[model samples]
Target: MQSSRFVIGVIGGAAAVVAVGALGTHLLSGTQSTTGLDAHSTVTVDGHKALSGDIVAGRAQSRYHPLPWVGDKVSDVICPTGLKAVAGATVTCTGHRSDGSTVSIPVSVVKASADSVTWKFERS
Candidate 1:
Protein backbone atom coordinates (compact mmCIF):
# COMPACT_ATOMS: atom_id res chain seq x y z
CA MET A 1 0.00 0.00 0.00
CA GLN A 2 0.99 3.59 -0.65
CA SER A 3 0.03 6.86 1.04
CA SER A 4 -0.79 10.27 -0.32
CA ARG A 5 -1.58 13.60 1.27
CA PHE A 6 -4.26 16.01 0.11
CA VAL A 7 -4.94 19.56 1.22
CA ILE A 8 -8.23 21.39 1.02
CA GLY A 9 -8.41 25.14 1.65
CA VAL A 10 -11.58 27.10 2.23
CA ILE A 11 -11.37 30.87 2.42
CA GLY A 12 -14.15 33.03 3.82
CA GLY A 13 -14.50 36.56 5.06
CA ALA A 14 -11.95 37.06 7.91
CA ALA A 15 -11.76 33.29 8.35
CA ALA A 16 -9.71 30.58 6.69
CA VAL A 17 -10.16 26.87 6.93
CA VAL A 18 -7.44 24.48 5.84
CA ALA A 19 -7.83 20.73 5.99
CA VAL A 20 -5.14 18.12 5.42
CA GLY A 21 -5.99 14.54 4.73
CA ALA A 22 -4.01 11.39 4.11
CA LEU A 23 -5.24 8.34 2.25
CA GLY A 24 -3.82 4.87 1.89
CA THR A 25 -3.82 3.94 -1.77
CA HIS A 26 -4.02 0.56 -3.42
CA LEU A 27 -3.93 1.85 -7.03
CA LEU A 28 -4.22 -1.69 -8.48
CA SER A 29 -0.64 -2.23 -7.37
CA GLY A 30 -1.31 -3.95 -4.06
CA THR A 31 -2.57 -7.29 -2.96
CA GLN A 32 -6.34 -7.65 -2.36
CA SER A 33 -7.80 -10.83 -1.03
CA THR A 34 -11.34 -12.18 -1.14
CA THR A 35 -12.88 -15.24 0.43
CA GLY A 36 -15.97 -17.40 0.18
CA LEU A 37 -16.49 -16.88 -3.49
CA ASP A 38 -19.23 -18.92 -5.02
CA ALA A 39 -17.94 -22.02 -6.78
CA HIS A 40 -21.11 -23.00 -8.57
CA SER A 41 -19.94 -21.44 -11.79
CA THR A 42 -17.10 -23.81 -12.28
CA VAL A 43 -15.91 -26.39 -14.76
CA THR A 44 -13.58 -29.35 -15.01
CA VAL A 45 -10.23 -28.69 -16.52
CA ASP A 46 -8.11 -31.78 -17.13
CA GLY A 47 -10.18 -33.58 -14.48
CA HIS A 48 -9.51 -30.85 -11.95
CA LYS A 49 -12.12 -28.36 -10.74
CA ALA A 50 -11.60 -24.86 -12.08
CA LEU A 51 -13.38 -21.57 -11.97
CA SER A 52 -14.83 -20.13 -15.16
CA GLY A 53 -12.59 -17.57 -16.77
CA ASP A 54 -15.49 -15.30 -17.62
CA ILE A 55 -16.77 -15.38 -14.06
CA VAL A 56 -13.34 -14.68 -12.67
CA ALA A 57 -12.86 -11.81 -15.07
CA GLY A 58 -16.22 -10.34 -14.14
CA ARG A 59 -15.48 -10.64 -10.44
CA ALA A 60 -12.07 -9.10 -10.93
CA GLN A 61 -13.63 -6.23 -12.86
CA SER A 62 -16.05 -5.60 -10.05
CA ARG A 63 -13.20 -5.62 -7.55
CA TYR A 64 -11.29 -3.11 -9.63
CA HIS A 65 -14.28 -0.84 -10.03
CA PRO A 66 -13.85 0.72 -6.59
CA LEU A 67 -10.16 1.49 -6.93
CA PRO A 68 -9.17 5.17 -6.91
CA TRP A 69 -6.89 5.83 -9.87
CA VAL A 70 -7.23 2.71 -12.00
CA GLY A 71 -10.92 2.04 -11.37
CA ASP A 72 -12.46 4.39 -13.83
CA LYS A 73 -9.59 4.00 -16.22
CA VAL A 74 -10.09 0.28 -16.75
CA SER A 75 -12.42 -0.56 -19.58
CA ASP A 76 -12.39 -4.31 -19.33
CA VAL A 77 -10.66 -7.30 -17.74
CA ILE A 78 -9.65 -10.46 -19.59
CA CYS A 79 -8.57 -13.58 -17.74
CA PRO A 80 -7.13 -16.75 -19.14
CA THR A 81 -9.01 -20.00 -19.34
CA GLY A 82 -8.64 -23.08 -17.13
CA LEU A 83 -7.75 -21.32 -13.90
CA LYS A 84 -7.59 -24.06 -11.31
CA ALA A 85 -9.46 -23.33 -8.13
CA VAL A 86 -7.16 -25.37 -5.94
CA ALA A 87 -4.98 -23.80 -3.30
CA GLY A 88 -1.86 -22.00 -4.54
CA ALA A 89 -3.10 -21.89 -8.12
CA THR A 90 -2.08 -18.70 -9.88
CA VAL A 91 -3.02 -16.79 -13.02
CA THR A 92 -2.36 -13.42 -14.54
CA CYS A 93 -5.31 -11.41 -15.85
CA THR A 94 -5.12 -8.50 -18.21
CA GLY A 95 -6.85 -5.22 -17.58
CA HIS A 96 -7.53 -3.10 -20.62
CA ARG A 97 -7.34 0.59 -19.83
CA SER A 98 -9.26 3.28 -21.63
CA ASP A 99 -6.00 4.82 -22.80
CA GLY A 100 -5.12 1.70 -24.83
CA SER A 101 -2.59 0.42 -22.31
CA THR A 102 -2.80 -2.85 -20.45
CA VAL A 103 -2.24 -3.73 -16.80
CA SER A 104 -1.31 -7.09 -15.39
CA ILE A 105 -3.35 -8.44 -12.50
CA PRO A 106 -1.88 -11.56 -10.93
CA VAL A 107 -4.20 -13.72 -8.86
CA SER A 108 -3.57 -16.58 -6.48
CA VAL A 109 -5.94 -19.05 -4.96
CA VAL A 110 -5.77 -19.21 -1.20
CA LYS A 111 -8.36 -21.87 -0.53
CA ALA A 112 -10.90 -23.98 -2.37
CA SER A 113 -13.79 -26.20 -1.42
CA ALA A 114 -16.85 -27.71 -3.02
CA ASP A 115 -18.97 -24.65 -2.32
CA SER A 116 -16.53 -21.80 -2.29
CA VAL A 117 -13.07 -20.61 -3.15
CA THR A 118 -10.83 -17.86 -1.83
CA TRP A 119 -8.42 -15.91 -3.96
CA LYS A 120 -6.14 -12.88 -3.74
CA PHE A 121 -4.76 -10.38 -6.17
CA GLU A 122 -0.98 -10.34 -6.09
CA ARG A 123 0.93 -7.07 -5.92
CA SER A 124 2.19 -5.91 -9.30
Candidate 2:
Protein backbone atom coordinates (compact mmCIF):
# COMPACT_ATOMS: atom_id res chain seq x y z
CA MET A 1 0.00 0.00 0.00
CA GLN A 2 2.82 2.46 0.81
CA SER A 3 4.49 1.81 -2.54
CA SER A 4 1.23 2.42 -4.38
CA ARG A 5 0.71 5.69 -2.54
CA PHE A 6 4.25 6.83 -3.38
CA VAL A 7 3.72 6.15 -7.06
CA ILE A 8 0.44 8.08 -7.03
CA GLY A 9 2.07 11.01 -5.25
CA VAL A 10 4.86 11.18 -7.83
CA ILE A 11 2.37 11.10 -10.68
CA GLY A 12 0.32 13.87 -9.11
CA GLY A 13 3.39 16.05 -8.62
CA ALA A 14 4.43 15.63 -12.24
CA ALA A 15 0.96 16.50 -13.45
CA ALA A 16 0.95 19.65 -11.34
CA VAL A 17 4.29 20.73 -12.77
CA VAL A 18 3.03 20.26 -16.34
CA ALA A 19 -0.14 22.20 -15.61
CA VAL A 20 1.82 25.09 -14.10
CA GLY A 21 4.21 25.11 -17.02
CA ALA A 22 1.38 25.28 -19.49
CA LEU A 23 -0.26 28.13 -17.57
CA GLY A 24 2.98 30.06 -17.43
CA THR A 25 3.55 29.67 -21.14
CA HIS A 26 0.04 30.85 -21.90
CA LEU A 27 0.40 33.91 -19.68
CA LEU A 28 3.70 34.91 -21.23
CA SER A 29 2.38 34.55 -24.76
CA GLY A 30 -0.71 36.62 -24.00
CA THR A 31 1.41 39.65 -23.17
CA GLN A 32 2.92 39.79 -26.62
CA SER A 33 1.31 41.51 -29.60
CA THR A 34 1.48 39.97 -33.08
CA THR A 35 0.45 42.82 -35.33
CA GLY A 36 1.73 42.92 -38.88
CA LEU A 37 0.58 43.47 -42.45
CA ASP A 38 2.27 41.67 -45.28
CA ALA A 39 -0.30 41.84 -48.01
CA HIS A 40 -0.61 42.42 -51.76
CA SER A 41 -3.52 43.07 -54.10
CA THR A 42 -4.77 44.90 -57.11
CA VAL A 43 -6.98 47.99 -57.19
CA THR A 44 -8.94 49.44 -60.03
CA VAL A 45 -8.28 53.04 -61.00
CA ASP A 46 -10.20 55.41 -63.20
CA GLY A 47 -7.41 56.13 -65.65
CA HIS A 48 -3.68 56.01 -66.19
CA LYS A 49 -2.73 58.19 -63.25
CA ALA A 50 -0.79 58.29 -60.08
CA LEU A 51 -2.27 56.48 -57.08
CA SER A 52 -3.55 58.75 -54.33
CA GLY A 53 -2.09 58.52 -50.85
CA ASP A 54 -5.56 58.32 -49.37
CA ILE A 55 -6.38 55.33 -51.50
CA VAL A 56 -3.24 53.52 -50.47
CA ALA A 57 -3.70 54.34 -46.80
CA GLY A 58 -7.32 53.26 -46.87
CA ARG A 59 -6.52 49.99 -48.53
CA ALA A 60 -3.75 49.23 -46.11
CA GLN A 61 -5.98 49.89 -43.15
CA SER A 62 -8.71 47.70 -44.58
CA ARG A 63 -6.38 44.82 -45.27
CA TYR A 64 -4.67 44.98 -41.89
CA HIS A 65 -7.74 44.98 -39.68
CA PRO A 66 -9.11 41.58 -40.65
CA LEU A 67 -5.83 39.74 -40.23
CA PRO A 68 -5.78 36.97 -37.63
CA TRP A 69 -4.00 37.97 -34.39
CA VAL A 70 -3.59 41.55 -35.64
CA GLY A 71 -7.27 42.53 -35.55
CA ASP A 72 -7.29 46.31 -35.73
CA LYS A 73 -4.15 46.75 -33.69
CA VAL A 74 -2.92 49.13 -36.34
CA SER A 75 -5.27 52.08 -36.18
CA ASP A 76 -4.14 53.92 -39.24
CA VAL A 77 -1.78 53.89 -42.20
CA ILE A 78 -0.20 56.92 -43.86
CA CYS A 79 1.44 57.00 -47.23
CA PRO A 80 3.17 59.58 -49.35
CA THR A 81 1.59 61.55 -52.15
CA GLY A 82 2.18 61.14 -55.89
CA LEU A 83 2.68 57.38 -55.92
CA LYS A 84 3.26 56.68 -59.56
CA ALA A 85 1.01 54.19 -61.28
CA VAL A 86 3.87 52.37 -62.84
CA ALA A 87 5.58 49.05 -62.22
CA GLY A 88 8.69 49.14 -59.98
CA ALA A 89 7.65 52.30 -58.12
CA THR A 90 8.11 52.04 -54.40
CA VAL A 91 7.09 53.95 -51.27
CA THR A 92 7.38 53.54 -47.53
CA CYS A 93 4.20 53.86 -45.51
CA THR A 94 3.82 54.26 -41.77
CA GLY A 95 1.40 52.16 -39.78
CA HIS A 96 0.23 53.61 -36.46
CA ARG A 97 -0.58 50.96 -33.89
CA SER A 98 -3.04 51.24 -31.05
CA ASP A 99 -0.11 51.15 -28.61
CA GLY A 100 1.16 54.44 -30.04
CA SER A 101 3.94 52.70 -31.94
CA THR A 102 4.67 52.97 -35.64
CA VAL A 103 5.74 50.35 -38.15
CA SER A 104 7.30 50.82 -41.55
CA ILE A 105 5.33 49.30 -44.43
CA PRO A 106 7.03 49.25 -47.78
CA VAL A 107 4.76 49.45 -50.80
CA SER A 108 5.83 48.48 -54.28
CA VAL A 109 3.93 48.56 -57.52
CA VAL A 110 4.29 45.15 -59.05
CA LYS A 111 2.03 45.57 -62.03
CA ALA A 112 0.27 48.64 -63.40
CA SER A 113 -1.81 49.52 -66.38
CA ALA A 114 -4.30 52.06 -67.57
CA ASP A 115 -7.15 50.66 -65.49
CA SER A 116 -5.59 48.77 -62.61
CA VAL A 117 -2.58 48.71 -60.34
CA THR A 118 -1.25 45.79 -58.32
CA TRP A 119 0.65 46.77 -55.21
CA LYS A 120 2.51 44.75 -52.64
CA PHE A 121 3.30 45.51 -49.01
CA GLU A 122 6.78 44.18 -48.46
CA ARG A 123 7.72 42.77 -45.09
CA SER A 124 9.71 45.15 -42.95
Candidate 3:
Protein backbone atom coordinates (compact mmCIF):
# COMPACT_ATOMS: atom_id res chain seq x y z
CA MET A 1 0.00 0.00 0.00
CA GLN A 2 1.01 3.67 -0.38
CA SER A 3 1.02 4.06 3.40
CA SER A 4 3.66 1.33 3.78
CA ARG A 5 5.84 3.02 1.14
CA PHE A 6 5.54 6.35 2.91
CA VAL A 7 6.55 4.84 6.27
CA ILE A 8 9.58 3.22 4.72
CA GLY A 9 10.62 6.51 3.14
CA VAL A 10 10.37 8.34 6.45
CA ILE A 11 12.52 5.72 8.21
CA GLY A 12 15.14 5.89 5.48
CA GLY A 13 15.28 9.66 5.67
CA ALA A 14 15.71 9.60 9.42
CA ALA A 15 18.48 7.04 9.14
CA ALA A 16 20.31 9.21 6.63
CA VAL A 17 20.14 12.22 8.91
CA VAL A 18 21.49 10.21 11.86
CA ALA A 19 24.38 8.86 9.77
CA VAL A 20 25.34 12.34 8.63
CA GLY A 21 25.26 13.68 12.19
CA ALA A 22 27.54 10.90 13.41
CA LEU A 23 30.02 11.54 10.63
CA GLY A 24 30.12 15.23 11.40
CA THR A 25 30.80 14.58 15.08
CA HIS A 26 33.67 12.28 14.29
CA LEU A 27 35.31 14.81 12.00
CA LEU A 28 35.03 17.59 14.52
CA SER A 29 36.44 15.46 17.37
CA GLY A 30 39.51 14.49 15.39
CA THR A 31 40.91 18.01 15.72
CA GLN A 32 41.44 17.54 19.47
CA SER A 33 43.84 14.62 19.14
CA THR A 34 46.65 14.39 21.66
CA THR A 35 50.43 14.53 21.42
CA GLY A 36 51.64 10.93 21.80
CA LEU A 37 54.12 10.15 24.61
CA ASP A 38 55.34 7.03 26.40
CA ALA A 39 57.58 5.85 29.18
CA HIS A 40 61.21 6.97 29.55
CA SER A 41 60.32 10.08 27.57
CA THR A 42 60.69 13.76 28.40
CA VAL A 43 57.71 16.07 28.87
CA THR A 44 57.25 19.53 30.30
CA VAL A 45 56.13 19.71 33.91
CA ASP A 46 55.65 23.04 35.61
CA GLY A 47 58.14 24.81 33.32
CA HIS A 48 60.72 22.12 34.15
CA LYS A 49 60.71 19.48 31.47
CA ALA A 50 62.41 16.20 32.34
CA LEU A 51 62.45 12.54 31.55
CA SER A 52 59.88 10.15 33.05
CA GLY A 53 62.68 7.78 33.95
CA ASP A 54 61.95 4.20 35.07
CA ILE A 55 59.16 2.80 37.17
CA VAL A 56 59.58 1.23 40.56
CA ALA A 57 57.84 -2.13 40.49
CA GLY A 58 57.40 -3.71 43.86
CA ARG A 59 55.32 -6.79 44.69
CA ALA A 60 53.65 -6.81 41.28
CA GLN A 61 52.77 -3.14 41.58
CA SER A 62 54.40 -0.37 39.53
CA ARG A 63 54.83 3.38 39.97
CA TYR A 64 56.93 6.14 38.44
CA HIS A 65 60.48 6.09 39.75
CA PRO A 66 61.91 9.11 41.54
CA LEU A 67 64.55 11.11 39.67
CA PRO A 68 67.91 12.32 40.91
CA TRP A 69 69.64 15.43 39.60
CA VAL A 70 73.08 16.94 40.08
CA GLY A 71 73.15 20.66 40.82
CA ASP A 72 71.31 22.53 38.05
CA LYS A 73 70.94 19.38 36.02
CA VAL A 74 67.65 17.48 35.94
CA SER A 75 67.40 14.07 37.52
CA ASP A 76 64.66 12.13 39.36
CA VAL A 77 61.02 13.07 39.94
CA ILE A 78 58.40 11.90 42.44
CA CYS A 79 54.64 12.43 42.58
CA PRO A 80 52.77 13.06 45.77
CA THR A 81 51.07 10.27 47.70
CA GLY A 82 47.68 9.01 46.35
CA LEU A 83 48.05 10.74 42.96
CA LYS A 84 47.94 7.82 40.56
CA ALA A 85 49.54 8.04 37.12
CA VAL A 86 46.31 7.27 35.26
CA ALA A 87 44.96 9.23 32.34
CA GLY A 88 43.24 12.58 33.10
CA ALA A 89 44.78 12.73 36.58
CA THR A 90 46.72 15.86 37.59
CA VAL A 91 49.75 15.51 39.83
CA THR A 92 52.53 17.73 41.10
CA CYS A 93 55.85 15.90 41.29
CA THR A 94 58.90 17.11 43.17
CA GLY A 95 62.15 17.08 41.25
CA HIS A 96 65.18 16.20 43.34
CA ARG A 97 68.65 17.33 42.42
CA SER A 98 72.03 16.27 43.75
CA ASP A 99 72.76 19.69 45.19
CA GLY A 100 69.86 19.26 47.67
CA SER A 101 67.59 21.60 45.77
CA THR A 102 64.00 20.66 44.92
CA VAL A 103 61.61 21.94 42.25
CA SER A 104 57.87 21.41 41.87
CA ILE A 105 56.54 20.22 38.54
CA PRO A 106 52.81 20.25 37.84
CA VAL A 107 51.83 17.53 35.45
CA SER A 108 48.60 16.22 33.92
CA VAL A 109 48.24 12.68 32.69
CA VAL A 110 47.33 12.53 29.03
CA LYS A 111 47.62 8.84 28.17
CA ALA A 112 48.40 5.76 30.20
CA SER A 113 49.79 2.72 28.47
CA ALA A 114 50.65 -0.77 29.62
CA ASP A 115 54.23 0.14 30.45
CA SER A 116 54.24 3.94 30.55
CA VAL A 117 52.16 7.04 31.15
CA THR A 118 52.39 10.38 29.36
CA TRP A 119 51.95 13.73 31.07
CA LYS A 120 51.75 17.40 30.14
CA PHE A 121 53.48 19.98 32.30
CA GLU A 122 51.56 23.02 33.42
CA ARG A 123 53.15 26.46 33.51
CA SER A 124 53.19 28.28 36.83
Candidate 4:
Protein backbone atom coordinates (compact mmCIF):
# COMPACT_ATOMS: atom_id res chain seq x y z
CA MET A 1 0.00 0.00 0.00
CA GLN A 2 2.77 2.48 0.78
CA SER A 3 4.58 1.88 -2.57
CA SER A 4 1.37 2.38 -4.55
CA ARG A 5 0.70 5.71 -2.88
CA PHE A 6 4.23 6.90 -3.69
CA VAL A 7 3.88 6.02 -7.36
CA ILE A 8 0.59 7.89 -7.68
CA GLY A 9 2.01 10.98 -6.05
CA VAL A 10 4.97 11.03 -8.43
CA ILE A 11 2.73 10.78 -11.45
CA GLY A 12 0.51 13.60 -10.28
CA GLY A 13 3.45 15.88 -9.62
CA ALA A 14 4.91 15.20 -13.07
CA ALA A 15 1.58 15.98 -14.75
CA ALA A 16 1.24 19.28 -12.94
CA VAL A 17 4.72 20.35 -13.95
CA VAL A 18 4.03 19.56 -17.61
CA ALA A 19 0.84 21.54 -17.56
CA VAL A 20 2.47 24.58 -16.03
CA GLY A 21 5.33 24.45 -18.50
CA ALA A 22 3.02 24.36 -21.47
CA LEU A 23 1.02 27.30 -20.19
CA GLY A 24 4.11 29.33 -19.56
CA THR A 25 5.47 28.63 -23.03
CA HIS A 26 2.26 29.70 -24.73
CA LEU A 27 2.11 32.96 -22.79
CA LEU A 28 5.71 33.93 -23.48
CA SER A 29 5.74 32.97 -27.16
CA GLY A 30 3.84 36.13 -28.11
CA THR A 31 1.58 34.30 -30.56
CA GLN A 32 -1.45 36.25 -29.44
CA SER A 33 -0.12 39.81 -29.74
CA THR A 34 -1.61 42.21 -32.32
CA THR A 35 -0.43 45.67 -31.24
CA GLY A 36 -3.52 47.06 -33.02
CA LEU A 37 -2.01 46.68 -36.47
CA ASP A 38 -4.06 46.29 -39.63
CA ALA A 39 -1.64 44.92 -42.18
CA HIS A 40 -4.36 44.49 -44.80
CA SER A 41 -4.95 48.24 -45.12
CA THR A 42 -2.95 50.69 -47.15
CA VAL A 43 -1.63 53.87 -45.53
CA THR A 44 -1.72 57.48 -46.71
CA VAL A 45 -0.38 60.68 -45.22
CA ASP A 46 -0.62 64.42 -45.90
CA GLY A 47 0.77 66.07 -49.06
CA HIS A 48 0.48 62.68 -50.74
CA LYS A 49 -1.83 63.98 -53.52
CA ALA A 50 -5.05 62.14 -54.43
CA LEU A 51 -5.43 60.82 -50.87
CA SER A 52 -5.04 64.26 -49.41
CA GLY A 53 -7.87 66.40 -48.05
CA ASP A 54 -10.61 65.57 -45.55
CA ILE A 55 -11.00 61.84 -45.00
CA VAL A 56 -12.17 59.74 -42.08
CA ALA A 57 -12.00 56.12 -41.01
CA GLY A 58 -11.86 53.95 -37.88
CA ARG A 59 -9.32 55.21 -35.30
CA ALA A 60 -8.30 57.78 -37.92
CA GLN A 61 -8.11 61.23 -36.43
CA SER A 62 -5.84 64.18 -37.11
CA ARG A 63 -4.98 67.54 -35.58
CA TYR A 64 -3.38 70.31 -37.65
CA HIS A 65 -0.86 72.81 -36.33
CA PRO A 66 -0.69 76.30 -37.84
CA LEU A 67 0.64 78.29 -34.91
CA PRO A 68 2.93 77.24 -32.09
CA TRP A 69 0.63 74.34 -31.21
CA VAL A 70 -2.61 74.43 -33.10
CA GLY A 71 -4.53 71.25 -33.87
CA ASP A 72 -7.11 70.71 -36.60
CA LYS A 73 -8.88 67.63 -37.86
CA VAL A 74 -7.35 66.14 -41.00
CA SER A 75 -7.97 63.03 -43.09
CA ASP A 76 -6.22 59.72 -43.50
CA VAL A 77 -6.77 56.78 -45.88
CA ILE A 78 -6.31 53.04 -45.45
CA CYS A 79 -6.07 50.55 -48.27
CA PRO A 80 -7.23 47.50 -46.22
CA THR A 81 -6.47 45.45 -49.32
CA GLY A 82 -2.75 45.76 -49.34
CA LEU A 83 -0.67 47.82 -51.80
CA LYS A 84 1.55 46.75 -54.68
CA ALA A 85 3.58 49.92 -55.00
CA VAL A 86 6.95 48.32 -54.58
CA ALA A 87 10.34 49.65 -55.63
CA GLY A 88 9.49 49.11 -59.28
CA ALA A 89 5.70 49.05 -59.16
CA THR A 90 3.72 52.25 -59.71
CA VAL A 91 0.97 53.54 -57.45
CA THR A 92 -2.03 54.97 -59.25
CA CYS A 93 -4.35 57.14 -57.17
CA THR A 94 -7.79 58.50 -57.96
CA GLY A 95 -9.30 61.69 -56.63
CA HIS A 96 -12.98 61.84 -55.73
CA ARG A 97 -14.91 65.07 -55.35
CA SER A 98 -18.57 65.57 -54.37
CA ASP A 99 -18.58 68.49 -56.80
CA GLY A 100 -17.26 67.44 -60.23
CA SER A 101 -13.57 66.86 -60.71
CA THR A 102 -11.77 63.58 -61.46
CA VAL A 103 -8.06 63.56 -60.75
CA SER A 104 -5.89 60.60 -61.74
CA ILE A 105 -2.55 60.67 -60.04
CA PRO A 106 0.48 58.38 -60.12
CA VAL A 107 2.83 57.94 -57.19
CA SER A 108 6.37 56.72 -57.69
CA VAL A 109 7.42 54.01 -55.29
CA VAL A 110 10.26 55.31 -53.17
CA LYS A 111 10.04 52.35 -50.77
CA ALA A 112 7.33 49.75 -50.27
CA SER A 113 6.71 46.17 -49.23
CA ALA A 114 3.96 43.65 -48.32
CA ASP A 115 4.46 43.14 -44.60
CA SER A 116 4.17 46.56 -42.90
CA VAL A 117 4.37 50.29 -43.62
CA THR A 118 4.22 53.61 -41.83
CA TRP A 119 1.66 56.31 -42.55
CA LYS A 120 2.56 59.75 -41.27
CA PHE A 121 -1.12 60.63 -41.18
CA GLU A 122 -3.10 57.42 -40.98
CA ARG A 123 -3.04 55.44 -37.74
CA SER A 124 -5.10 52.35 -38.54
Best by TM-score: 1
Give the winner by lDDT: 2 or 3. 2
Off by over 4 Å in 3: 1-72, 82-87, 112-117, 122-124
User: Judged by lDDT relative to the true structure, which candidate is superior, 2 or 4?
Assistant: 2
What is the clash count for each candidate, in the order shown?
A: 0, 0, 5, 4
Q: Rank the candidates by lDDT, best first.
A: 1, 2, 3, 4
Question: RMSD of candidate 2 to the true fold?
Answer: 9.9
TM-score of model 3 relative to the true fold?
0.31
Measured against the true structure, the TM-scores of the candidates, in listed sequence, are 0.63, 0.55, 0.31, 0.30
RMSD of model 4, in Å?
16.1
lDDT string, candidate 3, 20-120, tens digits: 97776555332112332443444544554333422311100112211121113334655543223467766565665457776665656566654455555
| Alpha carbon lDDT of each predicted model | 0.65, 0.62, 0.46, 0.35
**lDDT value for candidate 2?**
0.62
Better of 1 and 2 by lDDT: 1
Candidate 1: list runs displaced more than 4 Å: 1-40, 69-72
Backbone clashes in model 4, listed as residue pairs: 41-80, 42-79, 42-80, 64-72
In the predicted model 1, the residue pairs found to clash are: none
The candidate maximizing lDDT is 1
| Candidate 4 wrongly placed segments (more than 4 Å) | 34-124
Worst 10 residues of 1 by lDDT: 13-22
Worst 10 residues of 4 by lDDT: 30-39
Per-residue lDDT of model 4, residues 1-124, tens digit only: 9999999999999999999977765454321111112333444443222222222122223222222223232333232322333443343334332344443333333444444322322111
